[model samples]
Target chain A: MEHPGEGTRNGGSFVVSCESVSFSYPGSGRPALSDVSFELRPGEYVGVVGPNGGGKSTLVRLLNGLLKPDSGRVLVSGRDPATEPFEVRKHLGILFQDPENGLVAPFVEDDVAFGLENLGVPRKEMRDRVAGAIRAVGLEGFERREPDTLSGGEKQRVALAGLLAVEPDILVLDEPTSMLDAAGRREVLAYLETLRAEKTVLHVTHHLEELVRSDRILVLNGGELVADKTPERFLSDADLLRENRLVLPVVQRLALEIGLSPARLRTPETLAEAILAKTESGTRAG
Target chain B: MRLELRDVRYVYAPGTPFEVEALRGVSLVVEPGEVLGIVGGTGSGKSTLVQHMNLLLTPTGGEVLVDGVDATTLKKSELRRRVGLVFQFPESALFAPTVEEDVAFAPRQLGLDEEEVQERVLESLRALEAGELAARSPFALSGGEKRRAAIAGVLAMKPEVLVLDEPTAGLDPATREDLLALILGLRNAGISVVLVSHDLDEVAEVADRVCALQEGRVRAIGTPAEVFYREPAQAPATVRVASLLRESKPEIGAPVRFAETLDALRALQGA
Candidate 1:
């Protein structure tokens, strides 16, 4: 993955920044996040991935100041989320991994309208925003339906609608598809591609294959930002990832193992090229 | 000995408007010392199929046999000793104060003596390469380490059959591979392993037999090579590789997973 925040102009900078951010929940010696740092531009789609307990979830919470960093700083929209959290939250939207956690309203439309109402938007304007959000998430007809009746995938879409209703400048999600089946995961990902066009997106997941479309990838290991590369390079770095007990996508690893040209290594595509290249070379020695 | 299922069927919300079949008329056999892979998209019954292997769920219409004994008829304690089930994120199941305690809980629960429990706990941790973590609080361990500790917990029971339900479902690439290798090692050690996953690449790497479940029914069953492309389709990579080989020479019979060498691919392509 191309390292995000690199090679961009430094002027009028980062939407979010973390300087050695470390966090520990109360009464526990272990920290959920430790010594992490990164920056995001206005509309960049960044994928955060790592082994379990590498602080992926914690990183997501830090973005919104839900859990303040115990050691360092987390700034959202150029303001410290730890201090001016209300100000920071106003500009950013976050969708947690669990849709059940976000859907507090009895009805889908009421749920979508919760955030706008909380922000003190005028009642008349809130209705318009709720309608727009529901339509955006492809749930126009289900607005009045009880959330309990929705499938896990639909519930997640409703959660996304809730975030979109806020009309924040950026969106962050944490494994929203974990509870869904394969098809559900696909729908969520497909939706994200469109959403990315309108605002910055940071999707936190451990599944590297699912992150192929992300503009940049931030890999965490032991709560540290270890490898920040473009999705292509990051997945292709088999040796480096192995040292940290991470798996690169199978296709990329097979390609590198079989001696395919590094140039042929692209997400999903590199997989085929690698296998084909090796087969033609007839060197099954590895 | 083999773990076999005979005419297994399961239903959800029975006798209600939303009643649905999760698995149906599934008959299968898994040989000891073999790694059997189960693949299917979501709601295709993959999860339901795996839950049966460990007796986590009772089949409404079938019998699960381990070593020719019906699992459904076994006592709860007996079933726990025969099959160890690991969910996707095993760490979510951890709750002990220290790694040693977590790993020992299951065996200790079985009423093993302290010496026996401690010995098995240490051996299991060593097998997972986590023996040094004895005193550390499990919550303090890293992500990968926590997963290993969970596996160790299951291993302490000395289950003859270990079932991992989507073991690497949402893990980083490196961590996924590390766990896969460990699973492969367990199978090689003569433990019957059943791996349920959607990632065809992973199933290809470790499974001796691969079965696909589609909509509460068994859709396909065979060796990885046989099922990779012969009947139901596999992942895009496996499918492409199989297609190329079949086009070059039709005699390759089916796609072979374990031997994914370049020479094999070239040979399949009539080079």
Candidate 2:
């Protein structure tokens, strides 16, 4: 297996691979992405994070053939995404932040079926796939509801259903829950956990808490892949996080203040449990 | 200015099949120079409620009062000038060829003289820390720069009450912190801020008071600790962690903000 931060040494069975990819927008003096490299194995839940102009979105566009890298190669399942656009799309699906951007139909059912219909799936199979997709997102009863009438969280789920119906092997989500509220964000994040076992997921987000469960976290800065580490390692390094302009979540920050390892006490439950254990032992010793 | 909504109600598409009650008897107030946070889930009428602050949407029932005067009686422009409404994605509303012209649009429409408009444009851009970007094209600026330039458009109006809808939606951690600091600084300068967002942690950090909405109705309105502590499921991460600790140690008091939570945890260690 290839090690983290060693993406230049390729030659592994990776579902997605980028070899020293560099891209720049037209008329722009600075490159949007510079010498970025990463690899994603199948069923890998990788989280991408950085500042506003840090090329997170540019990297996502490159993976789906929307933007061609100015130099180097981008391979999805061994096929170059820039040259074989259709082939790359067959194995990958992208879900942007605004669900409104992806929804094309008035009715939820029809919107979910749009991808399958475009692929020329038979009517009988399309119906089954649409139902299955809707069920996967827990929208089984809202098939006839209009997209405009749904809540922000519901609309996002419908968009995911649309992508799931296509049966793509890889799912790349770009801030899928940023527009959502606390409850809505919980809903989408919970659904993403269900996707971890079957799909190679690349989730880009500004919320560090969302990356806690990720298999690997990639930090991008000034269009460069600055750091590639697991969530625990990433959270434990205060300097690395600060260099990338990231701050720990409130719970993790509390752990740091209480002289506890922020990585192990990442979540509220675990932190609370650890605190209780420490206090109980202290009470006996004192 | 002190803004008050007494049992405000708004219905979309009234007298039609699509009619829906967006705000149902919502009542609140924005005291002068204080930061009030409005929090809710989707379809909870947070956006609709903020629209009433600037009179973008007239209440179907009940009165909106600005400093004890009925808001409806004031000229629309006068009311708009006093209560600037920064819509969600305010950057999308920046249409002028340059950032300077965009920030100047509101003041110019206020019938201010040319010199006054120019002064407000520069002052507002500086207030948002975007003075260097005044000559740049809005489309050419970075996402954070564009967001600040757009907010400058509203700031140029010199509204008494500034209502921002999800100001930090897509911003990264550092930029989000900067915006929050800017908001607090504005409140310090005597402008009442109505921060409407889904970001619970941010609300807890800056808000003097918190308001919660549910299904077009006011569910709770109090200090951040009062509202968030009462609803543990919806509390900010720090408050949630504190609540988790309280289950085992009931002596711990309610702590809403980060510093308060840290203090509470420190007290637990008896340090």
Give one digit per residue, the lDDT tens place, for model 1 in A155-181: 778888888889888788787666555
Candidate 2 residue lDDT tens string, A1-286: 2354434324544489888999998867899999887888888899999898898988999998999999988988788889998878878999887676677796899999998887889999999999999997778888987776675567888998998899998999988887788877887788889888689999999999999999999988989998889998889988998988898888888889989998877677888888898899988889
Could you give the TM-score of chain B for each candidate, in order? Answer: 0.91, 0.97
DockQ of every predicted complex: 0.28, 0.64
Any runs in candidate 1 off by more than 4 Å, and if so which? A1-14, A24-35, A50-54, A83-168, A175-185, A231-247, A263-286, B231-233, B248-253, B258-261, B266-270
lDDT of 2: 0.87
Candidate 1 predicts chain B with a TM-score of 0.91
| RMSD of each candidate relative to the true structure | 5.0, 2.6
lDDT of each residue in B1-271, candidate 1, tens digit only: 5889888998876886546677879999888788888887655777677778867888899898978887767897878788888876678789999999999899998998999999999999998888898988887766567878998999889988898876664455666767788888888888888888766777877888888887778888987766766643345354544555455446544554535544454454454
* Candidate lDDT values, in order: 0.74, 0.87
The deviation in Å at residue A79 for candidate 2 is 3.1
Runs in model 2 deviating more than 4 A are A1-14, A139-145, A149-151, B15-17
In Å, residue B222's CA in model 1 sits off its true spot by 1.0
